[model samples]
Target: MPVLPQVLALLFVVTWGVGAALLTSVSQLSPSGYDFIIIGGGTAGSVLANRLSENPQTKVLVIEAGIRLVSHLKSIPVPDMTCNSSEDIQDVKIPFLATSLPSTSVDWNFTTTDQTGLNNRSIKLARGFVLGGSSSINFMTWNRCSNDYWDSLATASNDSIWTWPAVEYYYLRTSTLVPPSDGHNTTGQIIPEVHGQDGPVQVSLPGHATELDQRVVDSAFILGGRFTYNEDFNAGKSIGLGYVQNAIGNGTRSSAATGYLLPIVDRCNVDVIISTRVTKISGSLSASEIDTVEIAQSANGTPTKIKAKKEVLLSAGVMGTPQLLSLSGIGPKGVLSDLGIDVIVDAPAVGANLVDHPLVANYFTVNSNNTWDPILRNSTLFADVLEDWEIKRQGLFVDTPGNTQGYFKLPTYPGGVDPSTGPLSANTEVIFANGFAPFGPMSFPDSGSYMSVLAAVVSPTSRGTVIINSTDPFAAPVIDLGILSTEFDIVAMIQVIKDIQTIVATSPWEGYVTGIYGDLANATTDDELTEFIRNNAVTVNHAVGTAKIGEVVDSHLNVIGVSGLRVIDASILHTIPECHPQAIVYTVAERMAALIKHQYGI
Candidate 1:
């Protein structure tokens, strides 16, 4: 069982007097309308607020459901383990803190319906309820999709603006690249022309990567057949091994709230309110536009109506955005009717086309001294490392653990690895981390160390749904990821597992691992490997496509059949990108800002 904390102590843990003071209280807010009322002050919402509020003439009001807390710099732990407590503040300025578990107080903690594809097991889906959203809680790997994917997005929506050549500018404009540590990448890993230097978000390599990370990269080279080192994965083609670029700088997490909003909190035109959930969107059906957003708490305990003059932008993320739409009578008519809610728009695609990356891994026993598991197991070592992290932000504490990542395609496999629906993007990703398996229980040898090579199926043919459980706006939605719900995806996962085994058996990477887990290392056939995957498959937490473009929204991200509304978050992604969606989401928000500015002539 989990322990509870003192409520009073939590509420006052840190004073956000700097930025939180500028926020409006429910009672303090006047009934005055703003030019834009953005719901969910999350990853993309923070960006939207910063860019949209740049117009001195426009007033932007952002309502976030989570409260603010001062962050403490903490050391990184083994992957998938919870490190930060409710009292622990999340630093918006820190980028390496992505692997921390979903903070209970701030995380929506949604779970999927029993997956028929995966033995009827439900998976936990974590979404940040805080001001910065999942960007505040996600691993900050700075990677983008292949140009081909973005080009297809343009074609899908019948809009040239979504093309790679046009949208690529926003990708550059959103991030300021910081080169890796001088000592580690002396051979030059980053390509200068590919990144921007004056953007809001900060992107850089880990301060120092482990020897194991380098060995894994070297092993890719040892494979010698289309397995060469990629100097930079962000150059539109990421299909090889390399050091991962992160969103960390100055030894802290640089979330959208810190990068975009923290710097300009004094702007009088922008008003932010925390711990206030938007329950429903109310407007006249005849106008085909939104007029006001109803909040959980009114000034006098009744529902409060915050009006939007220009538009109501929904940056509420993949799950929350669609739930709010359904609640506000903007989703499928059948779903709304079942919940006893009148349908504003009978859009069937509103909660459909869910996508996510499903992952499974093989564990290996290594030298105790080579891996960092010992540090986490010993209290004294953990304390020392945590102290070092709090003070200097160096050593094992600063490592993003999985700072080394590899991407490859499995084209020719036993049961067909090609995506049944989408383009031929790389179907597999191997993340070499400095710990044991990212998920599941481990049976460690008495003294030997352990590390994990997580292989995730990035290009999955499986589609899921994010439907509202009931009309209750506060209830969690029914998220059915339907992972491995397709035959191609299943075969692809099995093939990737075999490929990882082959890679680890090579020179440099093989030298580190003393032994491998029996189920994979001993299995001789693909069917055995497939069965292991069926039992151990887990999500990489890369959920997207629930409310995607070309289906729910058009090129501009405006919810189809509606006016004065737009979705500017991961939910709008046509498909989950080949890489992490943080950087891509930033690009999407940037492009949306430009589009909104041009459309309304702001």
Candidate 2:
């Protein structure tokens, strides 16, 4: 239901010239073509390309499956999200337009297999098929998880390198805090010391002001106990409501491509090619080596073999990583054998342990006309707001869905058997939107302005799979998110829903909130609430732990049986973090890049 993108795209076309985006690929590669070949030129791959090519002696090649938008996109901090080749001009750059990107041309358009827990329904999963991967398409909430959540990785992997301090060093080095585009003073909005001063990605608080901003913040003071105000959740203590921070600056989206890849794409030792899919990764598994990659343009296109002298980095995200490995004969023995694939490593964990947060959203009528529904319904007001963003770099367009957010621990974790790692770990998450939140299948109300409240089970114990159904690389993988499969997750969600009900009952929202809309209103008992949850919940797309550490990959992220090959990206997270996994992925890539450099004495 996002407007202004299709309208404003023409304005940008007149402002900046338009043409077909660059589409170039390597038809032939020599034995010593490059020192490293990175598959999927995405979030982690862009970071690897930037860091590895820093040394003049090293050579790097990035293979991206999506088309590049512009030749010199890095020169501008916020480039047009869509071009002649893509749809929704504001989908990537404009923060408020995050909801518009999911089913667009840049999205992967993946649908999960029918889940037994979700009332036998399949949910659509949106991952970025564009240059920057999911980082380009995700709702840009930026925050590192708790200390024990990180230390738990060290315990699981049994490696000191995964410790909190070591990860924190790279975490602080991945992004820098920046002033909001609207020039609003951030006095107590965030803790400045907790963020980095100089880094590739730019992070900032919300740029534009919202009507529900003060009320959302004041709920902590008004409610008194569980709704305490948190100065900053990124400071190793994420427990209460706080101002939302995002990966944005100057009213522009700062993704891995705009921050790392595009800036250094013209380097002498760095090369990039697009619209090319890495079909199969074949090499000697017994010798702990993987050096060759087969790539093709289409399902019927013949694949060409490309050799790598040093290593082959698998930065192909959660689903794609497991799909590639299984196609290359490194997965469960029975699954591969049934598909006529010769089993090599017998890694049963390649596509297992998938974890993602299951979220539920509700809308309520508010007393104000400032919400986006009215503007979206009116062309004049929508254009006026768009003009404000174009002229002053400040407006509703600069704000994301979360104007203020809350993170909390469950009052009574199921049976006192908590899945969270420590005190800082969060069991519930809430996103307070000033306007109608974009999730699930629901149209805006006929007449009233509304506020959308979203609640999610962050500390979910349910797991799922992402496995290859065939040997064809062009085929989509079979993904099952296994949401609400456990009693722990269901119980936590039931309590969280009640907490949201209590928070809205405060004095601040007396006239504002009318009541809950949809099927959520009819639920009163535990049985009814569970039925509504199973019929309504959808994923927030914080998926991690497919090719997890200590199982499919070692502590260093290398495929256990394959040497000179590493699986970088969200797939390596063994246990999902309570916060959004985007920040953690960046921190992991930064840390891993440093180790990869030291190993080669760079």
Candidate 3:
């Protein structure tokens, strides 16, 4: 059989609940207090659980808000997948369905507040409610971001460990680069020596070759200078066109659950509780540091106060971390006072400094049928690819359709300030995928094949907030994505769109590219472009800065006013890392784990 598939990037089938456990009742919990309690057993929590529990004497407990999707052997076939919403494991495992997982049971489907920058249009904010958090359902990009961003993080925290060399060491040490499945030569695709050969998480290049992959590489070569090809985007220099690397290997997703939790969760000292909500944090409210958490199976269910003998780590992610803090009376006085909850601390920064990447996609009708339109339009081809993946763990089902990631350091706009830490950090990012853009409510054209150019302002200046609307733990937080709120963010996003448009229109794509589609075509003048942008601006789910370091949490990631409580997630980022955040999030978790162990001398 041949190796490469005609279709673009694919997906892979995985054995759910391989080593991870399911929801356990509060009665099943240990009576004796645990040494540590990690809230939200998602991405960061999973890692902390694994690392913290390594000491045999230190018992660790992970309270997760969502269910761990599990299935026994001889389960229903992938083709026989009857459940679309409730028991949809494919929504999490299949990379082709990456965006489709949102609005499902596994997702905390949040809608942001109306933004004036986007002409008062509110957008969807999807957060993972299941195990491994966003890592379980994201596009699986292992973007390490820029060295400059890490140095700035160290400067912001006044800690030398976050410096480029220090952070870069962990960046390479904690995860390994897996070889592509197709046996393709990776000589120019990646720098093998720069990556960690033996690590927990496995990252890999495109498993199969496609027609669009070469065109993207050729277009980068054709359009010299800024659009030059980058052999390794993960080597601290993230700017330029490069092969997209995902946290996947052996035709399976490499998430926190797969890489961190599954390996050490069954230890005698580790206790994982799923389908449990962390309601309120007690004891830590006062100067006395006897930190304990209240957990429940449901809103009406009985609550149990689980004592943390040593410390409590909050890994509730960007929205959940600050929202949880605010709910527990550890927030701004006005907010806590308004709710009649006793103010534990006057931390206005708990839900402040919210940042997100403003994303916009440009669609085009390509002249070639070599694209993956058939996979979207034809049922026969889809079935064949699905069968190929299920039977042999190969073909179009091994990855998402987007195969190329291009970053650019655009020139500063007129009267606009650059929020990026350094020149190495990308101001703009463009992703190339076959088939029509899967953004907005647009439908596929009845005739020609399509391609999407997703451009995101990686270094956005706009800031938003995350505040609890009600005291009820079930109530969704008021999230203002703050996308396109600043002129600089808008300017940067526009430049990315223009730059990608220029790339496609280059001499290499002269005949293969048909023409631009929809609003982008009509947007000619700067004012028209601005109007077009305001009407269509959205975020790419790369949120950070809420409950940021230096404000809400100290340099050590401990809560500013609270004791025995620390936030070790994306919420504690100094600023957005100017890229897809999973790599940075995992790296930070690893470092914080070591810090916690050292702090306790465990």
Candidate 4:
């Protein structure tokens, strides 16, 4: 045989071998059905699906509103490309789209009635509509709420099972911690023994850290406080200053759907339906039990009925979960009656107890000497960042600009146990992002506030409610955040503003920091700073407690007045966590799934 022909034959054989392996892995996934149907393949839904399907005998169906689309960008750990591109931001903005609804596709696109605390201005609320739920589109910063917040739930609900120690086990079960590597932080350190090393979801420090992150750490300590490096904030103690660990793994985004759902797609007992929007849940409501569920499909715009052999789980998140309950006639009696929805359960607490982390960004323009300045203003440089993300999966993109985070107990009432003694009545969550903008520095000025520090009031006393506007399931619900409506909430926010201003003023970067408002460069009064914050603050979109657990659902997350139907998402959080709600959602979903499996013996 000729040498050229022999070489070509060898090349063909190698290509064929690679192709065969790919086909074999892809073919392992087969369509299947389940006895229990879980709606929304998001944070909780994915965990529910994974845990429920563990039993070979039990069939599980996860109905996701969006498809499972994976790409290099989705998996990378870099932050440069994470929020820079339009596609990345759009995906992060709304992971799922409602095909049936025009203009508003994947995103619920919710808005709160004017927040009186925030200068009486309305803010946009974006919730995920995709398989992984909001876990796919969220900021990805992982921080479990403080012990006090979790302990309070136990006290309020009078359930020992809701205690911090009980929930801490689940947090450990679902997390995989990535310790800080050398040269990443000069002073910061993460304790690996306290964090989980071998878990499905990836939690690691960003590969790259800008100089600004170090300055923030030094500034936080300069503010005259103990700043300890936190390796695993998920351990349930989210205090002190440390590098923000995120849900990204191996330089790629590792959402719940990716970590939990994709790995089990081949299971014969689990069925995942994409592009399915569940409009209304119809069930037989006799006294306190629900026996059936009729879900509407967005693809064909029709409804299908399915009988629940055990229970129907609602992992539809804060927005969808409440909306589903209201549509099924399980909310306030008068509200449902007005909407012409037959009152099945008449649970008054269905859409009450709404809570969210309101964010206020304090911006400062750094000297051109700042590392991010060149890339922040140049599109070509931005393109290079994306290419680096695509090829090496290493660069600035993996770093979530807010590299360092801290939780502080702020003094609220005069002589309020002197925060030095114990946990204060209110705590402020400070997140420092390295980039100059909110979404992206170059995208839109109104969008990005330069060198932003998002200070959220972790434990606000204010509560709000969500109500249906009309009988139409597609109609957007009316949301009243009632933010800062309570005196305590206002006081907490004011303290946060003061804390942030003090950090910026006394920090090592005082010379490097220039106020967002050019004229207020020398402003020092607390009132002036508070006014600036009120005008600039926005919601972090970590909304929860709408269909609060315990109040609306039992310990197992089942609606109090309805059996077979349960809410296993952020909506069921008894109260907002002191940290981001994503990590809590993952833990709750995992625990909920175990509860369901044990209940059904499947």
Count of steric clashes across candidates, in order: 7, 1, 7, 30
Report the error of model 4 at residue 389, Å.
1.6
lDDT of 3 at 594: 88
lDDT of 1 by residue, 270-325 (tens): 88888888898877555357777889743244677777888999988889888998
Better of 2 and 4 by TM-score: 2
Candidate 4 lDDT at 210 equals 70
Which ten residues in a row are the worst by lDDT in model 3? 74-83
Q: What is the alpha-carbon lDDT for the whole of candidate 3? A: 0.78
Best by lDDT: 2
**Candidate No. with top TM-score:** 2
Q: Which sections of candidate 4 miss by over 4 Å?
A: 1-33, 70-106, 179-188, 226-232, 284-288, 414-426, 439-450, 514-530
Q: Compose the digit string of candidate 2's lDDT tens values, residues 59-102.
A: 88888887564321111112222111234333467677677677
Question: What lDDT is reached at residue 530 by model 2?
Answer: 96
lDDT scores for all predictions? 0.74, 0.81, 0.78, 0.64
lDDT of 2: 0.81
lDDT of 3 by residue, 226-248 (tens): 88899888887888898998888
- Say which prediction, candidate 3 or candidate 4, comes out ahead on lDDT: 3
RMSD of each: 3.8, 3.9, 4.2, 8.1
User: Lowest summed-lDDT stretch of 10 residues in model 2?
Assistant: 13-22
